[model samples]
Target chain A: MSNCIDFYFDYSSPYGYLACERIEAIAAKSGCTVVWHPILLGAVFKITGQKPLTESPLRGDYAVRDFSRSAREHQLEYQHPAQFPIGAIAASRASLWLRDNSDPQLRAKTADFIHAIYRAYFSAGQDITDATVIAAVAGSLDIDSEALLLAIATQAVKDSLRIEIEQAISAGVFGSPTMIVNNEPFWGHDRLEQMERWISSGGW
Target chain B: MSNCIDFYFDYSSPYGYLACERIEAIAAKSGCTVVWHPILLGAVFKITGQKPLTESPLRGDYAVRDFSRSAREHQLEYQHPAQFPIGAIAASRASLWLRDNSDPQLRAKTADFIHAIYRAYFSAGQDITDATVIAAVAGSLDIDSEALLLAIATQAVKDSLRIEIEQAISAGVFGSPTMIVNNEPFWGHDRLEQMERWISSGGW
Candidate 1:
């Protein structure tokens, strides 16, 4: 049986972006596949009654310090994401629509698009809240930028987001970059290694 | 004004119990007061999209490894708490009432209560889920065990628990053993030093 990890991601999260980048390598090494599910992180928070990281100064301050520690531990290149809490709604919708095509390379291409958007926001310090950056991301994916834009423009994407939020709540998901394998949810980027460990243990 | 750290605690949590023992010493040295708040960790999980440590095999696995490391680093005498997800409701309700009595010796006494409870559960392999054990904890306080039991039997105590839960959700808390000073929450025992730093800075 093929082992799969269902990843719930939001483009605005630096850890989500980092996890997206690192998980594939980890998954490949562990003989597992990542199933990407893009959902609005803001909505997840609203439904779950979570305040932003900025609310608990510890969360924000520790996030800054913790990410530094994590990057070093993982041996990944990371600096603080320049514009935090960047608008992720658009990208989330686009990725949901992209899944309908169901191409085998869909997950990889979508990851690339998401990674590029993260770079644009965190590294390039561009306005990911701007539609042009999103369109550029879709264009780079060779996905029809116009159709993708139109799809996100409709309520279809919005409704999909609603369902995703509800499902995540029901599943007891609390934070970003959650990996669910075999009905179990693994939270946080730091947990990626444990996910690999579980897979190597035969996806128990 | 004496600096205060708003403390989030659950009775059956060995870490919460251990922290109560050490925090007093740490605070005395650092010079701060622990304003204890009895909150249900279950409610924190419900609202914050978090799962109990019991639910995440990966988190549970990591916690075991991490606690072993923390034990060494903090120079703590720790044996991992067994019979986890033990009913903490009684403990929190007991603490809420205990704090109200305002005995001059509450701080030191509270630390002793926590130490005995943690050691009983972790080292002595006692079932803290048993009411007899809980009654013994109450007895250790020298209050009439029956009166303490009767006090925890009220609707008012449950309401106080609810209010504490609401406050934690409002404060953006997502985990246990969270410390707060002047409405600033510093989560995890690891962030205790930063909580101290924030108090010194007057940046709030």
Candidate 2:
């Protein structure tokens, strides 16, 4: 009755951040291991017909209420990213570089980074294009800030993040924080408990 | 730390029917009591500016895919209901009538009645406007079909259903199967685990 949970993530997704925040506790409770799988949201959206905030019809008036209900229900804080579709390339790259050699607890740390970045972008209307905030988020998790910057700059990490994006596309992942446990995919933060229960129950 | 859970429902909402199926199981697990609420979808759409299905941009189309994934993850069977948006006045009235006979474990039976009606509309694509199916559904529930239908016609059950709707509106019930523990509302079936946890932690 053992399995590994691969959590697909993107820094720009507040929902992804929400899953990162608490999925580990659930995983622990359900007796499963967590793996961090960072993918490019931009790529996933290209094929999924998923549009950024400004492009979605319900955005200007309804999205705020829509997401607020979901976020508040999940007990995660959000305001709206200041910059629409903030370039997540660097954030993804840093996340990739910090993989394996860094903490596998990346699940929890990544959740934190997603929240801080969402707050930075949507609520305060800050520039997520700045490497400083990204680095600060990494630093807050005790991961090396300077190293994260270097990692973001390295072509290897950059290309790796790009590959992760490609991988998400090839694997049919269309959303953030898609918890893939035992090769079963649960697409939203709302599906987290279902994934854990799937694992806990040995995939039924 | 006890609070009433006001469940807002549109008898025509497939999602509401879906949520109703396992709601009491969820409530028992979460230690919450559900106040069965029935609101007219036609009325809600009029006030909230939520468009009717034919006008709402097929947002629900893609949602079926997501819900399919969720259902699979949860190990639940989700055959899309047959008939949707059936004339729910009778069913809603009947549910209000059943409230007087509250049984802690009867939600599943209640859900069956709701599901049968949804099937009458969506899957069968029948005119749920048919009195026969409505009578059949109520009869199947082991409820007195003549009495229930008579109650719907007499304004007795209709008035009770209206009061439940007003109660839900006053309690800020925005959606169905909403779990309110200690007056804090958690809308959607997905939040059942958190609702349970919130209760276990004494409303945190």
Candidate 3:
């Protein structure tokens, strides 16, 4: 098995944002690398017949409370996004474009771009569904904002994200913040510790 | 805001079984008592539009795997029941009957019966949906098996369980192993640690 963790997440997922903030440290502790795969939960939900957490009946209220409580437990900053559960298509496409960039420097900034976008939406309550908002977040991190905006709008980048979501669904990922280590899937941000234990113990 | 943890769970829920094995110590650590509420997820699912974890599409396979893996993580023995996702109506009724008994000693055996029923189903692969199976498990604990069976079969016991499920849904409990500490709902067994922190730190 590869010493890499495949981290699957949706930009609009609060748990996904929380996982992105903590997965790196958990991965580094066991000498493992994290491979981030940004996907659309909306697409996965179509097959899984699931709805957004905040839109569900009873779970909706608990999910909103858990989002901030979980973040505080991890000592991470979180604020409820004004417009949540957004499409996040532009941000997801931007992440994939950055990761697949030919330039190693831009590729290395993929994680940064992901964190920035998540922080912008979850911490600062920004509307990340807007391409310009995504571009501005990228620009703040020394990335070429205009290029990213253009790249995400291209059919190739959009298709790349579509394929990634399909692959994620095929791999048995039905939720955000799913971490796969050694081909075993752990879903939810709550499974991070279990995922770490699986890595440190070399599978239990 | 009571100094007690209202633990709502379904007998057929694997995570609920796992939580049952650990909640007391967590409660005791913070000088809190645990009030076990045996709920029917099937009823809640009717309103929440959720299916059993092991019945969902991609999540089904992962839930099956997570059941045993999570059990192992907690160092608890687990065997998947041959007839999974059983109704567990009999066990739930029996649990309520035991808890509401006039005799204090029989009322005290409520926890024992809860553990026995869960262990029989999850650890020993017994069909807890059967009233006779539930009775036999209760008999092993020195409880009056005949009386228990008769009690669980009564309209009163059945109504009690129905009312309990209604109350659980009213309180926003849509899943198994939901622990409500100080009126704050923490769903899933994985949140036990956060629940403990909430107890120890008096909320964040």
Highest-lDDT candidate = 3
| Cα interface RMSD of each candidate | 9.6, 7.1, 1.1
Q: Could you give candidate 3's per-residue lDDT for residues A52-156 as a string of tens digits?
A: 878878988889988988999889999998887788888889899989999999999999999999999988878888777887898898999999888888999
lDDT of 2 by residue, B1-204 (tens): 454555667766656656766676766666566666777756544444444443222234445655555556555555554554454777677666666545544444665666676655544555556667778877877766786677677666678877776676666554555555566676666776666666676653
Docking class of 2: incorrect
- In terms of lDDT, model 1 sits at 0.67
Per-prediction TM-score to the true structure, in the order listed: 0.57, 0.63, 0.96
Q: Each prediction's DockQ?
A: 0.06, 0.10, 0.81
- Candidate 3 per-residue lDDT over residues B1-204, each given as its tens digit: 448999999988899999999999888887888898999888888877887777778988888888888888889999988897878888899999988889999999999999999999889888888877887988899999999888888999999999999999988899999998777999999989878878877787
Tens digits of lDDT, candidate 1, B1-204: 546677787665545655665677677766687777767777665544455654553345545655544455456666766567766676666667666665665434655565666667766777766657768976866756687678778998767777777877777666668776666566666556555655665533
Top candidate on TM-score is 3
> Model 1: residues >4 Å from true position, as ranges?
A102-108, A202-204, B1-116, B119-204
Question: If both were scored by TM-score, which would come out higher, candidate 1 or candidate 3?
Answer: 3
Q: What are the lDDT scores of the predictions, listed in order?
A: 0.67, 0.64, 0.89
Q: Could you tell which candidate, 1 or 2, scores higher by DockQ?
A: 2
Each candidate's number of clashing pairs is 2, 16, 0
Across residues A1-204, which tens digit of lDDT does each residue of candidate 1 receive? Answer: 547878887777767867877888887887778777776667667654555554444356556665655555456666675667765787777777766555666545766776777767656677777778889878877877887788788987788877876786666665778888787666778667656766676542
